[model samples]
Target: MIKRRLNVLLIEDHFIEIMKFKKTVSFAEIQHSITEAKDGAEAFKILEDKSRMPDLILLDLNMPKMSGVEFLSILKNSEELRHIPTVILTTSDNQKDLEECYRLGISGYILKPLKYKDYATKIEAVLNYWSLNELKKY
Candidate 1:
């Protein structure tokens, strides 16, 4: 368990996927506050408010408004927001997507697991690791 509660921004389009992620996180036993965004545009709007800035961002590659890559480009270029750790949490196994995300300065890229159990396990590990890792908050 984390010593402190983390504020996480989850940008995903699919409602079912969002719910699954929330469920998985809940079972992980990690203390966190998750703010959901349907798309990158909404996520960016939330980020505009410095007080609401998230400790981490879980981004999906495909979405209706402003894809994940576009969001990452903007976030990485921003002096104020660049320090926040952004991880790609998507179903896309595209090699190009992986390379582009890394090039754009993503902290990590993870392929979404197919099974619910696997998803929960992967999320638990990720949350545990991040909770231990040091981050530079802006």
Candidate 2:
């Protein structure tokens, strides 16, 4: 069954890959409006706009200007941004990365090297879980 994609925020330095993956793999399969950010700095800026706060944040590590760790550190301390669930979906499969993300209170962590099909599956799962929780709070 085709699913409506939720509004997703993807924070990656490489915009092309994000766009191509979104289009080619069909995050739009679930009909998601994927908002793109070039780096952690840009992502933070977008978060400031109350109307643009994303339901799920897909963050990448090892970015230029502002790294994902730096952003996570900042975010966890901010009451305004802390409630937004940010997932570390990055190439750093290192244990340290995973540990740090959990310590910073990330909602989830995903390593790279994931198959294209699996990537879509994970994305779909995140959307579903978020939707369920949102409904539960009502």
Highest lDDT, which number? Answer: 1
**Tens-digit lDDT track for model 2 on 95-119?**
9889998999999997654576776
lDDT of 1 by residue, 1-98 (tens): 34556788999999999999889777766668899999988998999898888988889999997999999999999999988999999999999999
What lDDT does model 2 reach? Answer: 0.76
What C-alpha lDDT do the candidate models reach, one value each? 0.88, 0.76
Candidate 2 at 21: error in angstroms? 3.8
Root-mean-square deviation per candidate: 1.4, 3.1
TM-score of each: 0.94, 0.83
In model 1, pairs of residues that clash are none
Against the true structure, whose TM-score is highest? 1
Model 1, TM vs. native: 0.94
- Candidate 2 stretches with Cα past 4 Å from truth are 1-5, 24-29, 135-138
By TM-score, how accurate is candidate 2? Answer: 0.83
Model 2: ten consecutive residues of lowest lDDT: 129-138
Model 2, residue 78: C-alpha shift (Å): 0.4
